[model samples]
Target chain A: MTELLARLPETTAAHLGLSLAALTLGVAVAVPLGVMAARQPRLAGPLVGVASVLQTIPGLALLAFMVPVLAALGLTSIGVLPALLGLFLYSLLPVLRNTITGLAGVDPAVREAALGVGMTPRESLVQAELPLALPVILAGIRISATWTVGTATLATPVGAPSLGSYIFGGLQTRNYAAVLVGCAASAVLALMIDGLLRALALGLERRRRRVTTASLAGLLGLGAIGASPAVCTLGTRDEAPIVIGAKTFSESQILAQVLAGRITEQTGDAVRTVDSLGSTVVFDALEHGQIDAYVDYSGTLWTTVLGRGEPRPGRTELLDEVGRALAEERGVHVVAALGFENTWVLAMPRAQAERLSVRRLGDLAPHAPRLRMGGDYEIFQRAEWAALVTAYDLRFAEQRTLDPSLMYEAVRSGQVDLVAGLSTDGRLAALDLVVLEDDRAVMPPYDAVILASERLRRERPDVIAAMRRLAGTIDDATMRELNRRVTEAGESPAAAAAWFLGRPLPP
Target chain B: MIRLIDVTRRFGDRLAVDRVSLDVAEGESLVLIGGSGSGKTTTCKMINRLVEPSAGRVLVDGQDVAHQSGPRLRRRIGYVFQRLGLFPHMTVAENIGVTPRLLGWDADRVRVRVRELLELVELDADAVAERRPDSLSGGQAQRVAVARALAAAPPVLLMDEPFGALDPLTRERLQGSFERIRRELRLTVVFVTHDMIEAMRLGDRIAVMSDGRLVQVGTARQLYEAPVDATVRELFAAPRRQARLIESRLERGAP
Candidate 1:
């Protein structure tokens, strides 16, 4: 436990506690909403359904969705806006359900007597109904508290690191102990909440037994003494929040650093990041409010955003409309597309490419029947890859999508003949794989677009400006270097972002 | 004064109260004497608007009570059901202060009034006031209910078998306290009871009913002296005769 505590940042633990603090807030929100919904059965149907739906959305998807949505609205980790919002929405069902159930379960005669003695609906609720309902409501809160603590740990992946840093740090290093520590800490926090809330519920239960004010006061004093440690502080006066988010790949991390650096120039506020989520996840994050801003590829927005399986439109038209379509439908603003497209670029040994004369997909088609293809897992299923293969009608000897990390070994050992490398990948140069050019430009340009949540757009003009400054700045070489620092240099994201932010990209 | 006029209550197809009416004059304790389902509790609830009349109006101070909202109406009409319904969350004094507190009485005034009501119910003012309803005996809790009912000094009070749960000794003691307090307050009270002896002991005037209809209305002495019908006469005579029968049954074939 001591080693675990020592490894985890105090900053991370503090955010974890504060974010879960919203469990109480969620209970406060849920109880009244639940009560109102209960009183009017018609409202309960839709309102309760909404809370359930919110919980069903996967945590990663929801966090990514909220990022740009909040960036547009200009809220972040500093405001605790998205974290509070997501947790609140998540916690509503249990507290609300319990409140309604508890109130419904109270003896009718007791309720009647309360009303019969001049208790207004409000007074009757506070004096009679709420006291009775508290135990049930608190039980629901216990569930939400456990769930919220568990989910908030994922906030670390999205620049909202609470205790989740331990889990992610473990994932990065393949150390299960780190994940266990995170889970254990969260469970401990949840147990603490359960104990305190149960004590509160029991004290309220025992309130009648201690009729004297002095006894009640003593109980309250003891509770106050007990609660002081669990409270987690949020926001420093000096470092304000600049919101940043990232797409799935390495280059997106570089762009996030670019944005984070630019924002620091304006307000001297430290950036809050939700980084390295899936392409779709990042898009949704911006839409909901988890991330303030993130980088995305033009090709992804074309097919993924438009909901088309194969790329129907050509490269330039797709790129042009990508911005317009995302803004119109998703409320995502694509400020500017950067210079490079990290599109699928098939490569192999230089001798192999030359001997086959495989300059393009069509050029490689005749030889493909005998060649085995190896690439990242996602490229095989991507629309760009699918369309190119179908267009050329090339059938390789065998196609295998390997993890990007294992690609060099797979190619060097001749486990596969061809490499489906990304255009800006540093490994293509480092491993000396021949990058076969796509003569037909079949793959749409995978350019970066700056996104903002509607909240961030209305609220933080400075953050948008800081990110807009990064538009047209990153090219293939610059981003490759940024990735090299992160992957090869063994530098952490914060240090990597700091170094990259200090050094301006060449125009 | 409390008055019910031509009240008729229906529970599904059953006639719980069928055009029955009566008056509870100030300083007069009027208990409705009835069997189960004879509309005695229904009539009492109508005064505080707990159970609304299906057909006629109840009047308190000759003003229509049906128009008063539940909370506003109940404060002026003190009511205690057969089950007591003392808030399990509150102490005896706190339960007593419920009405006065709802009426916006200051803390000091409400506390003083609560103490007086507990004393009126023959409770030790200091000792019993802070005790929880759960901790109290059935009889003591019933007394607390009576104290709570009279806390705001409502001129019109209604009770549905308030001492119905207690044992004989505690029930009689509470009945005596209520009688003496009723004398001192000169309050209009509508009490419900199926117990003929209890009705005779507590009521100045007794309204006897059967099958939801009023069979007779008269002073306690008049009820025993001359009832309106055979059923009314039997209702008055049965309790006194039952006591004698029980006494005889206990002595039957004994040494």
Candidate 2:
């Protein structure tokens, strides 16, 4: 219990730091921007219009959007900055709008009186205007703080550590305890910050002044002190199936969903992942024994997933070689590769490529550094990309790695000169990012494979066979268009998966 | 010494204060008396430039009020009000210290000044300095308001009916206090009020107005003794006498 409590503080600190930083950063950017806008009426409307538009974008899409942008900038830390940027954007309206509203609402008489007193504009604002406007300004701060804390929970998707981890991870793995802890802690944090700030507001009103923000600091400190007693008891239960987990892309989620889904279906037993796992988090969880099994790609297994050295080989031979090596090396098993090839193919704008006379990977090597490269999340970071770059000496002025769904748009928008896109993703055709042939053969086959904990093979061969039913059946053309409809056409992945399994297309 | 030269203040076509000229010499207290909407308040406010005249100019000690900007101008001119618009945020001392602080008085000077002003207003400085405006009594707040206006010893004080809201007893007490303060400070005061008795008691000189136009201007005795027109005779000094007679002798006759 003491150990658990100790860990709890660190966890809570992480959440608070992320949430507060998000709130502060949001206020820092938005208030000044809003002030500028309000002063220039023409600017204020459109500036806020842009912020409101940001809020209108879905939370998941926005976080996903930050992944490649931040990753390209080399900011792939598994915590606050990613989440903070998103929450900061989320917190803008309350602070920005309220600041403008509060300051604007000050009576004209008071402003004139302040000015009349020979106060410099800055002095007048502090002594006369802001004092009168304090109640309203404090109101904005309270709202922004509460909002940032709440929204930062969603950062768990992009490998951020927060309360949402419990909810999403628990949902994935069926671990209600971890979910309960995550949720309960976050609620307390939001409530605590809200209460303390409210007290400060009330105290200032009656006394007509403020002291140090000690009241808020005290609560945050107390929360830390209170969190110290729970860390030890949860002691590296990291070995339990409930402990280790991973989140890759949709395929990883679907594979985890299918495995966990069928495990409960057949045996009437449930084990939930403690937190929702993202791409890097899944590997970390595997290394920490924080999760038991996850489904990743064979080519990813060769390059990124396993961090293997590059080799010159064909699709089938390379996959086989990588699969054999991983079993020998990592003490992990490839139960099966789903009936599909999730290969990374460099795509270009069809018309643009034709016009440029660029036909293949080697054909465009000279222009590589000058062109823009767009690809999926893992592909840009993979050895396959490096080998392709090294083999063809490919370089581009800009490189963008995006979600498989957005690969086409990156090319469509002319934002990228080349895209390392999935061979089977349907978005390639829909958005017109043409697949340039990899004539140099530097890339390997990426068969969708379900890698599991060795403990699982000794225990559950039935689960393996059930998953193998999906092995090597989904072909490039059939799978490509299906994936496109789900991502690009906005259909559900579960519905898409159901349709894929309904066919006898797998060999 | 505050003077308004042919001041015409118009609010979107209605002449709030028409081209009226008035002068308040140093050490002289002038009272502007009229019913509401007669521009009594507007004329006093013009001396401070609170209400800018649509045409014409006001001068304080020969310096144009329009040109005298910033704390230098404000520090030299004090303003009081009937309701005593004391800021709710600051304590009594802080409110009283506004003008001094604005004039860049040192902290020690402000302390001493605030203490002396509180003493002059008959408030215990120590008790009131830490207390907020809302916590102070109405009479107390008003005294603090007077102290605030007098803090920097502005040569000219424009008061808009400073005692209009007080009870008659409190009004009489404050009037006595003001007379003493006026002699010691030698301030050029412009007081606005509708109460004829208050004007007679407080003002050395009186200016009466009707419909945004000045009807009469003279010493209080001169206005009362001569009363150039029937309106002046009926309105200025008779209202109080009528109230007294009607309440006593006429009460039994009416019954």
Cα lDDT tens digits, model 1, B1-255, are: 777889999999999989987877777888888888887888778778788899998888888986767788888878887888888878888899998988889999998888778778888888888878889888888888888888888887888888887898988988888888888998888889988889889988889888889888998778767877888888756777888888898889545
Over the stretch A253-299, how does candidate 2's per-residue lDDT look in tens digits? 44454555545544555555433456655554443333456667766
Candidate with maximal lDDT: 1
What TM-score does candidate 1 reach?
Answer: 0.73
Interface RMSD of each: 1.2, 2.8
Candidate 1 deviation (Cα RMSD): 7.5
lDDT per model vs. reference: 0.73, 0.70
How close is every model to the real structure, measured as TM-score?
Answer: 0.73, 0.62
Instruction: Flag regions of model 1 displaced more than 4 Å.
Output: A1-25, A41-46, A62-82, A154-161, A165-189, A208-245, A248-251, A258-274, A277-302, A305-490, A494-507, B11-14, B67-70, B224-226, B244-248
